[model samples]
Target: MSDTTTPEQLADDAVVVDVREQDEWDAGHAPGAIHIPLGELPARLDELPEADERDPLPIICRSGNRSGKAVAWLTQQGFDAANVEGGMKQWAFAGKPVVTDSGADPQVI
Candidate 1:
């Protein structure tokens, strides 16, 4: 089965990868999340931590759809990845930290 994680349950050391497009990512994203648009994932594999590192890799998008696909692909490649259920929407609703490129108020786009 595909691995999945909730925003509230994300681990402290987990590596968060935001797979939204540039416009969406610029609006708001988890602080420190790696910005790798889903379309660029295949070419950006090197940006992800190695599977042996054992740190959880939580993939997120505007909602959960894209991240779920990413989780499936990454898992197939042997990385310990999981879909961030409900994605940024749930994260913001749960009061999780978010940041914007211009220091403006964060919003899910």
Candidate 2:
């Protein structure tokens, strides 16, 4: 797997998955992120876009820890996944755009 990507480094093909709970997702998450909620990931894998087993994906959570496990599991399953390093907390600290309210509006810090 590749290294984690920063908001500025996110490419068109880079998929961002948010593993936080639904309430956390409603509060705020990276713009363009797809919510899968950690607990539901196994059943929801089909919801993810098709990717090469080795293509990179950056997973985010409220903090970095949960995303690390996500990354590990995905990688073991032959899907290339990277933890967001600092997750949404870092994204917020860096003042990147976050999408709330069904993405009707984006909050940019």
Candidate 3:
């Protein structure tokens, strides 16, 4: 099984990849997280930051399900990746900062 990490366990400087759809991502996401919908991930793999076993890439979505699948695919492609358990919902619940493209307040969709 792939590794699963909770939002609270994330490092402040960790580079996070958000794999939700565009609409979901525009709704809200972790500050500074990269936006790459799951469907586009294969085509956009090069856009992701470099990662390794010691520093696995963090992938998240509205819920853990999508991110988990992403982690599986990424790992197969030789990327060290982990799924964010409970995803954006848990991240927001953990008091992590969420942001939007607009200046409006952010909330997980």
The local distance difference test score of model 1 is 0.85
- Flag clash pairs in model 1: none
- What would the TM-scores of all predictions be? 0.90, 0.79, 0.94
Count of backbone collisions in candidate 1: 0
**Residues 1-109, candidate 1, lDDT per residue (tens digit)?**
8878898887433469999999899888888589999999989999986543544588999889999988888888878888889999998888888888899988898
Lowest lDDT block of 10, candidate 1: 48-57
List, residue by residue over 11-95, the lDDT tens digit for candidate 3. Answer: 6545799999998888888886999999999999999987755867899998899999999999899888989999999999988
Best by lDDT: 3
For every candidate, C-alpha RMSD to the true structure in Å = 1.9, 3.4, 1.3
Clash pairs for candidate 3: none
* Order of quality (TM-score): 3, 1, 2
Q: How far out, in Å, is residue 33 in model 1?
A: 0.4
Models sorted by lDDT, best on top: 3, 1, 2
